[model samples]
Target: MPVLAGAEPFSHTASTEVGVLLCHGFTGSPASMRPWGRYLADLGHTVRCPRLPGHGTTWQECNRTRWTNWYDCVHTEFETLARSCESVFVFGLSMGGTLSLRLAQQLGDAVAGLALVNPSVLTLRKDARLLPVLGRVLPSVKGVGGDIAKPGVIEPAYARTPVRAAASLSRLWKLVREDLYKVTQPMLLMHSVVDHVVEPVNSRVIAEGVRSTQLTEVLLYDSYHVATLDNDAPLIFERSAEFVRSVRQVAA
Candidate 1:
């Protein structure tokens, strides 16, 4: 929460009837979710998107953290939102989605539902990740600092990819694959069938693995990895809003 994905502060302690905790992908910051958060905030729901430690900073800083630290960050946000809202729904992008799924498994009925965009869980194309030598010798990329990239669109905040962090992801995902059955909360997952990052099969796996009968997968036909900023971002946002409404209806 300290280096909150680059925004520099938390939401004012204002209360709302409904709340959402947004989580960004691995090596990414809350900036990935800021647009979505702002949109949801306009809906009169309190939204918190905390930056994972070592993110929105240097990739070397991120290299020092692991998936557990990332989960801890979002879990704190989740608990904080739970204390002040009547209902809590989680939305996450990429690895952020993986954390959301894990939390839903942990919270069960306590978490109303989830929305995932281009989730990272089964997205890896084999054991391939960042090239170790380059990650070790080369400096962070000049742009989004290990951040998410929307297809054909580029983010200046994104920098270098952290190999150490990715190594951790490779291991953490295996654990998630075995535990997917524990996520039974109603979920609406969105992914691009042609995503260059996470494979479309990842979303399919989520829709099939989670026990929730309300789970659905929305495909972004015109987007790539970072659907959040691509041409289909509007569709992702609307579909996500609808998912929250559907879950809230069920919870009500």
Candidate 2:
């Protein structure tokens, strides 16, 4: 499957010792995070937004990959940045946020801080439990993409949901939530008042589970699931940058 043009990975290097790793959601590509990555890069920070495995391609292709593959991609990027940058912060959307939390838990102080938007730690829908069984028979289902509330904005995402891959993601969610207390760094969470794909409770779970004393949650009244591309996008960008700076100052 040919990758979408705008969905390619994006990287920028600045002279700063501080770097940021931006992770996009499940079925989403770097296209979903390009604006936010560029905004931070323009501010002179080193940034890397990588296309995850099984993403930016046909839904059939995505079904072949699992959560470990996706996590490996971002984990490698984090390692590369950590070797050079004095401090590295991670920011992610949706499932990407779930991965960021896992990184924070695994690497501890190596991950200076985290900024997440509408992160999912668990599925609120009861049917999601059947994914492990149904995935074997049902290869794909209707996609949950393009849930943005903004008019005329389309997220570059798979048209179908690969049940097997989704089931793999559910496993990752369980592992992340179990060790949430280990992610005790400065944290900033942004969640929409009404999100269609990932429920608002997803954010609440992270807020309540993580032991970060520096946790901050911002409510987005105007945006939906993909707030990074919705009406409050600018606000998400600005506040995230500000949060990164404040965390850096404290570490210094």
Backbone clash count for every predicted candidate, in the order shown: 9, 0
- Best-fitting candidate, measured by TM-score? 2
lDDT of 2 by residue, 1-252 (tens): 688878999999994678999999998889889999989999989999999998998888888999999999999999989877888999999999999998999899899999999999998899999999989999999998888998999998988999999999999999999999898999999999999999888888889999999998999999998889999999999999899889988877
Candidate no. 1 TM-score:
0.86
In candidate 2, which residue pairs get closer than 3 Å at backbone N, Cα or C atoms, i.e. clash? Answer: none
Q: Candidate 2, which segments miss by more than 4 Å at Cα? A: none
Q: lDDT tens string, model 1, 1-252?
A: 234335342453444678888888766666657678777877778888887777777677877788888888888988999999988889988888888888887778888888999887764544345534545665444332322335445542445667667767666777787888988888888887776667777887877787888878787887776677677878888888888787777667
How does each model score on lDDT? 0.74, 0.92
Q: After superposition, how far is residue 191 of candidate 2 from its true place, in Å?
A: 0.3
TM-score of every model versus the real structure:
0.86, 0.98
Give me the candidate number with maximum lDDT: 2
